[model samples]
Target: MQASTLAALKELALQCARSAGELSLKRMKEPFTVEYKTSASDLVTAVDKEVEKHVISMILKRFPDHGILGEESTFAQDPAQFETLWVIDPIDGTTNYVHQQINFSVSIAVYHKGEGLVGVVYDPSRDELFYAVKGEGAYLNDRPLHLDRIVSLEEALLCTSVFWNKRAEQMGIDLIVKKLAGKVRGMRLLGSAALEMAYVAAGRLDGYVSLSLNAWDFGAGRILVEEAGGRVTTMTGTPLPYNEKSSVMACNPTFYEELQQYLHVAENTQTD
Candidate 1:
């Protein structure tokens, strides 16, 4: 993609994100209906649907030829059918939005021919916008983010998620958590993989590892992290295609190698 095209997409994505975020904030405190998806713990809210509808409508109107893939709605215009695709997660941290009324975000990214060209993640609660174009450096609220260059796994701070079937998957993650718990400065579970990746790009967290996130969950944040001088791959350190659902490990270059070694072990031990 040309720099100009990327710039335009970035601007449009940012505007859409802010608009969706504002809508989220306005309705966050209201009595909203919540529903369950695959499982009870896996949640969806009226706001999630409404926000996604607003974003998709805007994108479709602006770029009629572009395809959209969103969490609330089924994928339209399969990736193989289009050169340009917009992946959106209108409410990334829906559980947080429902309970704590915080920490959620609006994530958007444009991919051309399967390569990410633009990315944006907006946290309305904090009013922080994290964005990047393919070659351009990433930014947190307009300030360039400098990825950590030192390889100090022991000193790093890691973030991860606990799945709905917490007990079933605990062993693998527990091993890694125990091994790194004493070594790393700290560990956190912020409940949103996209926000975690954005945090990694912003240098607020050293790395983020999670199992089984869909394309919409990490699509945008993946580009942002890579643009900020970080790396993202499966837990086993394999390259990821936007179409595949897999365990994700994203971190600055400094800690990627060491983190990969541990994550690879966890990945191998998982039976399901």
Candidate 2:
């Protein structure tokens, strides 16, 4: 994509993210209906759907032909149909949004044929906006975000999500978590993958891992981390597909190699 076009998309994503975030923040203060999707632990609120609709309308108003792949209301399950696609997670941490009313975020990203062009993640609680235009670098609010390298895992502060299911067991998340928690400087479970990945981009966290996530969950975050000079891939060390569910691991170059080795060890041991 041309630089100008990419910039335009970035601006649109930023606007949509901020607007959706503001709406969600405002609604969070009020009572809203909540429902479960897969289980009681998995939640969705009216605000999530409302914010997604608001964002979709805003994007379509500007670019009617563009496709929208949203968490609440997905237009297309397969993203290959659209030349330009907007991937949105209106409220990334729904449990946080519903219960704690914090740690949640609005995530938005634009892609052209599987290549990320614009990424925006907005945290309404902190009033922080982390954004990136491909080749333009990343920023948190107004400040540039460039991650500094960490030499070793023992010195690294990392975060991860552990969902309870067969997938988690199959991924050997139990072993991975136990190993990393003992090895890293500290471990955290932030509830929001996008926010955690943003923290990794800002160098606030050295790395992040998750056994399962959809495209919308990490769409904006993957771009932010990469633009900030970090690397993101599946836990198995494969490139993430444009709009599919997969595992995620994000960190700097040094951590990628170091962490991947540990990940392989856990997976190999699980198989053995």
Top model number, lDDT: 2
Worst-scoring 10-residue span by lDDT in model 1: 162-171
In candidate 1, what are the lDDT values of residues 132-235, reduced to their tens digit? Answer: 88888899999998795685888888887744436425665765656766788888888877888999998889888776788888998999999999999877
Q: Write model 2 residue lDDT over 1-272, tens digit each, in one string.
A: 77777778988999999999999988988989999999898999999999999998999899988998998874644556788999999999999998888999999999888899889999999999999888888999979999866558888888888635466677667666787789989998889999999999998888988877889999999999999999998877888887888878898767688888888755543321
lDDT of 1 at 209: 76
After TM-score superposition, what is the CA distance of residue 149 in candidate 2 from its true location, in Å? 3.3
Per-model TM-score on C-alpha atoms: 0.93, 0.94
Candidate 2 lDDT? 0.87
Model 1 residue 86 lDDT score: 91
